[model samples]
Target chain A: MNFEFTEEQLMIQQAARDYAQRELIKDVLERDAKAEFPADHIRNIAGLGFMGMMVDPKYDGSGMDTISYVLAMEELSKIDASVSVIVSVNNSLVCYGLEKFGTEEQKQKYLRPLASGKKIGAFLLSEPEAGSDATSQRTLAEDKGDYYLVNGTKNWITNANSASTYILIAQTHPDKKHKGINALIVDKDTPGISLGPHEDKMGMRSSDTHSVMFTDVKIPKANRIGDDGFGFKFAMQALEAGRIGIASQALGLASGALERSIAYSKERKAFGTIIANHQSVAFKLAEMAVKVENARNLCLKAAWLKDNHLSFGIASAMAKQYAADIAMEVTTEAVQIHGGYGYVKEYHVERLMREAKLTQIYEGTSEIQKIVISRDLLK
Target chain B: MKILVLIGNVPDTTTKVKFNADKTAFDANGVQWIINPWDELALTRALELKETADSCIESIVVANVGRVETESTLRKALAVGADEAIRVDADPKDAFYVASQLAQVAIGFDLIFAGIEASDYNGAAVGGMLAELLAIQSVSAVSGIQLENGSLKINREIDGGSQTLAMNLPLLAIVQKGIAKEPRIPAMRGIMMARSKKLTVATPIEVEPLTSILSFELPAPKASCKLVAEDQAKELIRLLHEEAKVL
Candidate 1:
């Protein structure tokens, strides 16, 4: 009903914007260039409550509304998508999933630390053989009395090397396919779990991503999330929430790119006047603004639906698809506006372009989102 | 030791001040409110004291005077790490009125903290008035405070420098910037916990504003700086001595 932000939400948004502009923006270029994670900045964000924006009060969370979470994500992604993902995965993917599905004991042991920003969390679903076809996973979990022996390799896992806890998806019964999928909470220090070398990424290099290999890793049965067959459902539900986060991140990246493009167009001179005076440059900036605004609206609508306990799966998927595509378009146009300067890393549009590409691929790929939308429409 | 912090919700410092058409009062149409910066220092220091001494400290209670807007600020105080918050629900228009309301609620607290001055009115009268009403020892402009047994060791600014004084428990102190840690952002978890924390709002006794607003206006523009030629050093010195009278 109310489209405008609440006073608390506005305050938090302003705080995030102020903090990002003051602390993150200054070093974002350097960190992206050198592929260095800003550990201190991450600590500062944790100190500011960005790390656990939606966590429940009992576990030391901000217990903020979902819209506030999206707002914070949008602000962070506007500065650097890599940092946003690190925060998003910790808040939405790992922590939210556990809190929603974990038992009291599990919450006390796993959710508390992650929600408190004391540890990092990762969602491990994609494997080399099963990227979109998550049900065809080769990873297996075998029940052995009190423990489940897990053995599988998950690739493209975000925060693999740094995460203290991972919500890992594996097959409990290979013959049952999707119905056999199960979610397991695995600690980073488990004996048979080893992290592969960090992936050499093209964008979002500040976010550490790699492969995780489990060689007969023994996990307590208590760590199993929900029922044995509910892993796929839980993973899908978590991704639905994650799609909204990605959409907000896309909106943020586009917004940042568009803002810079506008500022530059107005400042750069051509034919004895500012380039912004040219219809060509002016139209491009206008179009970029339109796309960013549309994407932001969609992201907000999806987040609002989820917060109100409505069925937002289709809306979330649609928003993700539209926002991701728009981000790519806006970032690419932003670079074009910079012309020769945009090609070089010195200008940041090139980095924005690179960052925008990942949003189309992660959470759910643009293609996967279409499938989700079409399937929902057909039903 | 029990510490009490007095919080206030003042117009956000960033908001431009405006006046009503009749010129009788300031326009508050779109003004945003925030926890007074000075009171944040008080709240932070009280929380710090509780953290360091653990069980030796009994509780950290925050008190405020205003409407529901004060509730959010109080929640923020709690999230920043206070144990509880109490709102004296009345819009006291002047320092003395607010202090009178707080004086009625100052019982059982060993140490009390408030901002040296509120940002909205810039009135530095609440601490002294509250102290006088409660008949307790008080100190203002306190830059540092520590608890020792049953007394408070206070470091305060004076005209030329700073001074240190010690007062027994059940005293009042106005906190300044250097008194404690800067306010911390309520983390996701802390924010969630604050929703369920103990926040009590009570009806305050009636009070009247002692001072009324006449009008509001912006401060005069800063005098422009003049560029003095390199060879005019002697002339500049003469101007400073004879014209500007700074000699």
Candidate 2:
């Protein structure tokens, strides 16, 4: 197999790099300090057609390849994971799910706008107790001849406050367990929808996170993504690719951390010599490079599989688990390499270290990823 | 008006320079390739001109002289709004070869734009040479550009100031910064559609080489600075005279 990226993929990577360096980096420190969402950045990303990167061109998306999406994700995450997560949720979770399973009506209304970045989309699955266990979904949606009354509280929801559309997974028949669930596209303006206090997050502060509560929210039957009992399977399928997005983000964070560490080692001096000349500092940088490269290979392989329409669930899970683990490890080491300077927010390693932790916990937790891998492995 | 944008490939600005043991050539092991920044600036300006003055311009095409690898760079030009691209399949040895190959494909274009210099070699000769080869009016180091009734008004950066020049169509300009604020990044949709766009890959016409390289060398590594007490003006002066040879 050719390991080289195609011409289109490389261009997308460069675009993301330029956007991140020019536009995103300028406000990252201030945004993180003030916990601002940078709504304007979302508009800019949409204008660049990044939100609909992999959507079909007919639907107002760029109809790009999955490899391009991964490349863009990597570059965007290298500078600001807070912004990258917004992209991830839109491209990987909401857009992919709707496009894969959405009917003509669903695709026409929600998927189009979400893909074009005219509106923001959020994935609603996790509840207070259902973080990794899909079978424990507590959200309820009662069948109402022509509509469903949806009521649930989804926490740790990215883009919760500002999202116009939500792809929510709720139980229609609790007795049937996972088989009873259904995924619905709910508009934010629907009655009985409200938001809780924004989560006081430690990292990715530029992303708006909150607990979205729905009390007697009514949505037409047309909003159902597929037939009844498709919610659980839909979430599983979406996360398989969503994992790749997270993996790429992790790889980008690791790469950025390694790059910063290399620069710091070259400039900072100790004992009349540059720190990079020291064996210990050099080895740390080496290890960081190794981890970043390994994670990148795993992510690209998984993306390639998905792009070619092959079996990618196992590869995606493996990439997610490995990349997230290394991202956390690398960023932590990057901070260590930075010494006391890294501990402060000004050095940026501390922020990256914090950003790295979310990849391990979200999309699918490391433990959940292990479960996915172990199940596939044993079979 | 039809526009032809001259695109080139150069090593990324950040690639670390590492020479082989004999120092004959650089190791390409991890060197990343990117569109030359100057060419990119020129391409962006041309595309912007087309976008704003769509009624005046008919189409824009990009041309490059490199092997299959450079097709990727040219594809980027297409994604950035070039109507099509023409790539001459050969390694460009020098500005003369590059200019000759470009002039062959650029025959019918009403306007031509290129960056003032490629970042790799800093050889700022390609545009002027191409203009001379094609027997067209040439402008160098252009910045601000505007189109009027079937003609153009452009700013040329001169020594310590900028000058405005009015020229008609079939004009060739080699541009520097201020031609465009920042090079436009190709939107994701543009990139997705770039693959199937009309990219005409033509074989290069043979031409005699004008220059050859002997060997490459990097400047010496910077030496550490010396700190002197505030009262040591005489010592500083003496050191500047003897060590720096600047007195």
Candidate 3:
């Protein structure tokens, strides 16, 4: 029943807020226009230990709780989602997977650097043919006596240009179907690994996303996570944890838009007085506030469940679906509230609106999340 | 050398000011609290000075004069790399009261830092009073400090320019902006370690306040701007000259 955050959590939130408002907001518009990656900012945040906010301290992480991670994500996402996505992937997918499943030796060599943010990591699951249907992975990892030979095309791979380590999911036995998949950690400097051109994305353009082609890439067998054919369950569990991060990002977008709309409405005058004095604009702001609050509650609930080691799959799915949808709705209303100014990049509502669309499309699409939730409820 | 940074707890800069019923106090409901901007910068500079290998800074301690709720602000100072905190359990009624309370715990520190003024009141008096109370030399409007050859090098903003001075230890520096480039954000490690950092609460000696506020009033709302058509240059000039009275 306690809603108040701990002193540490509040301080972390403030730190993230201060960094985003002071540092990230400085070049966000220019970065978005140029579609440039935030390399320096990434190093700076990693120095701040945001890249592995929830990893164990023994492995060079901050050893923070999931709730603190959610709070930091929300604050950072308020100004720049591109940066937040990198943080999310490294913490939830890369570091969490390694810490939870990797062998002691694997943790010592690979997880240490990744969790310390000395190196960045990426998760490769989706392909051209397998978007929502993850079981239809066409990428194959052939079993060899000493090592596994990996060959696959991973699409929409985030941090493709900058990451040094990748947690790759590929099929090892086609007859075993979904049970045949394995998740392996591969060094990006390995031979026969090439990356396609950075995709020109609609929003979050500052985030580096590309298609990675692996041609007979040799990976150590010791790098495989969990038992044989455990990659599917590992990826699913990681995604369940990752949904909290995305949900918080969406919440940030929604709340950021609402705040801008409120500020703009009070200052912007229309026919006779400020638009905020009008009932129409005021009601829209009220509705946006409600949506943002609900989204925040849902995000926090999912994060809390995860932190408590409770079953958070269904909760996270619901949060991701609701928050992403509401982010789009709220950002659109924020733009409408700004009148003609919302169409441009100056006031920042337009950029927030653009960023909101990706939250619904990435991680797990809204349709897929609905499937997860409905399936869980029926079962 | 041990450093003591005088921390001030203040409302966030973006807070919308609201008065209590009788207009004597600020409304605290929903107001977010933060470390004073200048004080944060002062702490940042202290940390930067400590980073040098040759510097003899042993630890940085932040002291505040406030109630229990101000512990969060003090904890934040710790999370930003201060070694420990000392809170004078009392209401910071006035600059004199605050300086008087701080002087007790601040006696042993080799170097002390005080922001020129708290953002809320802008009293601009605590640093000078503390120096007088402790009978130590004080520098005002200090914008920079560096440790050079075991001596303190200070850069202070003066009328129309700046001046650099070489000073000794056991001095109170009333710092202004440019003390550091930016306030340091607490890293995740610092946040975790802050929980275990020692925050000592000292009992405050009774002190009589030299000033009290009877009421508070906000400045009048700005008049709406009268925009003249771009083509009517003469009209705009006339309005500016007559109404604004700046010509």
Candidate 4:
């Protein structure tokens, strides 16, 4: 297998790096402290066609492959995961779902704007009771002939305040189990839609996260994706593709931490020389480097499988679990390498550690990914 | 008005410089190539001018003189919004040779831009040589360029201050930094479109090089820093006087 990246892929990576290092790193600390949404930054990247990088060019996307998407994600996540999560959800979940499953009319009306970066989109799936057990969705969408009335509370919804379109997943018939579920595209301006207060998150606070309450929201039947019972499969497939995005993000965090630790160690003097000259500190750096490299390989492998139209479910699950776990481990080591400075905000390793915690818990929790892997082996 | 940007292929800014065993050639085994920083800034300004409503600038073309490996760097310039590219199939032996190759393709453009120097060699000679060969007026140390009512308004750094000059077409600008805020990053669409943009490979004429490298050596590593305690004024003075020899 060829390990070299194409010229286009390398150029995309450089563009993302230029933007992240030059723009995002400027006010990241202040935004994190204030928990501010990166509104202007979102607009900037959207203009760069990052919001829909992998969608078809006919639908106003950049028509990039999944490998390019992974490279861009990793570069952007290195400086600001808060911004990268917004990009990940829009590209991997909202854009991919519509391009792969939505009808032509739906694509024309809804996907066009999102793919062109004219609007932001969100995926509404998780409820307060259904974090990891996605099959236990309690939100109800009552069938009303031409329109379906939706009423539910979706918890931890990212881009809740900033998105213009939402891909809502709800059950139409509780007795029918998952087969009764349907996914619909709903306008954010629809009446009877209200958002809860922004959750005070531990890290990635710059991302707009809130609980959305849908009460008697009417969505037309024309908006339903795939047949009447395709919501479960659609969500699963979308998340399977989405794991690559998060895996890359986690890889970025680990590598960013290691780079900072290396730079700090060489400059920080302890007894008589720089800390990097000490074997203890140097060995920790080596281990962090190894973990980051492994995580990168896993992420790229999963991306390659998806790009080549192969079955990537198990590979994605493995990547998500391993990358998320190592992100936490590497960031912790990075902090320890920085000694007392790592506990502070300016050093940035502390914030990376905080962000690493969320990667393990979201998309699919580490426990949930293990279940997916073990179940596949047993079958 | 059509604009032509003189592109130079150089190692990435962060690359560690290394020489071959004989010290007669650069060791380029793993060096990553990029557009010269000043040229990138010049291209950025050209794109900005083209975006204006009253712009007379029609299209921007980038030209480079190098072997096929430098095609990627040329393509990168196209990815950042150049309308087309031209590559002269030859090794750029020196500034005069590069300018000679560029002069063959740079004719008929209303305006030509060359960075003051390439990051690698810092020769600072191509733009002047090209202008002299083409029998056109040249502007040096240009930091700002704008088009006002179809005329070119330019800014250049003087000995103690800055000065602005107004010039006509068929001129070459030797640009320095501050030509633009920063080089524009290629958008995803731009990267995709770059694959289809026209990159013409022109035949190089026989030209003798005026200069050749004899040998190469890297500068010595920086001396270690010594810190003086806040209360140790006497020791600091003694060290600076005896060791540093500047007191």
lDDT of 1: 0.86
lDDT values of the candidates? 0.86, 0.90, 0.93, 0.94
Stretches of candidate 2 off by over 4 Å are B17-30
TM-score of the second chain in candidate 3: 0.94
Tens-digit lDDT track of model 3 for A321-341? 999999999999999999899
Candidate 3, A246: how far from true, in Å?
A: 1.1
- Each predicted complex: what DockQ? 0.28, 0.75, 0.88, 0.92
lDDT of 4 by residue, A1-379 (tens): 8999999999999999999999999999999999999999999998898999999989999999989988999899889999999999999999999999999999999998998788999999999999898888898989999999999999999999999999999999888898888999999999999999999999999999999999999999999998997898899989998899898899999999999999999999999999999999999999999999999999999999998999998998988899999999999999999988999999999999999999999999989999999999999
User: By TM-score, highest first, what's the ranking?
Assistant: 4, 3, 2, 1
Q: DockQ order of candidates, best first?
A: 4, 3, 2, 1
Model 2, A281-349: lDDT tens digits are: 999999989989999999999999999999999999998999999999999999998999999988888
Candidate number with greatest DockQ: 4
TM for every model, in the order presented, reads: 0.79, 0.95, 0.97, 0.98
lDDT by residue for model 2 over B30-102, one digit each (tens)? 7778788988888888888888888989999999899997787888888878889999999988999999998
TM-score of 1: 0.79
The lDDT of model 3 is: 0.93
DockQ metric, candidate 2: 0.75
- For every candidate in turn, the CA RMSD to the true structure comes to 5.2, 2.1, 1.8, 1.3
Q: Which lDDT tens digits does candidate 1 get at residues B1-247?
A: 7788988888888898887887777788898777898998788788778887766788999988888766877877776678888888888778888998988887888889989998988888999899998999888889998876656689999999999998776889888899876665554445545668898878788777688777667687776555679999998998789877999
Worst 10 residues of 3 chain B by lDDT: B48-57
